[model samples]
Target: MTQEDKINWLKENEPILWANTFKIAKGELSDKQTMFCCCGKLATGLHEDNCRKFLQQVKNETAKRLQEYIK
Candidate 1:
């Protein structure tokens, strides 16, 4: 997806993630699922998934910004 689309998608999905993250932080959930909630890797596979998604977003947005600059 385009950077803008991806960014908007993130923004929209952030609330759900944020709430879940809070629960994780409060010990209501496992760290494995919410480890990446604060930008750190979780012990579970979920952290890996979040890491990949975060990296993809960063990469896409960086490329998009670069392209805009080149223009």
Candidate 2:
């Protein structure tokens, strides 16, 4: 509830959190894209914010592709 409590909880649960986060994100990626993402994340380690960024990027691209397909 408190900031300290939140920080402690995150530290204590990081492995589980990391696993679940990757699991869900992996499910969302296409096979090729998933490999690319995994390589990037592994290379970047602590600074990888690609999960969120990639989702936004994919959504935008998908929308653009759909519009092009429709036209």
Candidate 3:
């Protein structure tokens, strides 16, 4: 697949995550919204790269949140 096809596939398959790229790149996410995105993606089985990256981006301050979910 070409780069363009890969881009289109992401947009089509991960619309929510694709739309979030702009906000994520800008580092505009609050702790609450970051938590929401992580949980929502896992609970819904979205599991896109954005979700993993976003979780890692916020991981330091979000250990408590992860603890709650894991326990």
Candidate 4:
């Protein structure tokens, strides 16, 4: 899927992840910052895999948007 598609999917299927990923992508949050879980707990080792995947997808989408804007 395209970056936009992946982002939309994340937004629909995972709102919390989408919010944090978008914030990081937009430079509102630092890469070193930790994301919190929906259950009000720290999402360190518990959600690392999914969080990493979502962050990567958000970064990819931001890069694509930047490239398109440059073009």
Off by over 4 Å in 4: 28-71
Per residue, candidate 2 scores C-alpha lDDT tens digits across 1-71 of 54344434443556465345444544455444533553455423232355666654444443333332221
In TM-score terms, candidate 4 sits at 0.36
True lDDT of residue 20, candidate 4: 62
Q: Write the per-residue lDDT of candidate 3 for residues 32-58, one digit (tens) a residue.
A: 454356445542224433565554544
Tell me the alpha-carbon RMSD of every candidate: 11.6, 13.3, 14.9, 9.9
* Cα lDDT computed for each candidate against the true fold: 0.45, 0.44, 0.44, 0.53
Q: What TM-score goes with each of the models?
A: 0.28, 0.32, 0.32, 0.36
lDDT of 1 by residue, 1-71 (tens): 66666445544655464344434433432333454443555535455445655445444544443343331
- Model 3, clash count? 0
In model 3, how large is the Cα lDDT of residue 56? 51
Per-structure clash totals for the candidates: 0, 0, 0, 0
Candidates ranked by TM-score: 4, 3, 2, 1
Query: Candidate 4's residue-wise lDDT over 1-71, tens digit each?
Result: 66666555656766675566566564533344467643345656545445665456556755454443331
The lDDT leader among the candidates is 4
lDDT of 1: 0.45
> How many Å off is the CA of 67 in candidate 2?
1.3
Worst lDDT 10-window in candidate 1: 23-32
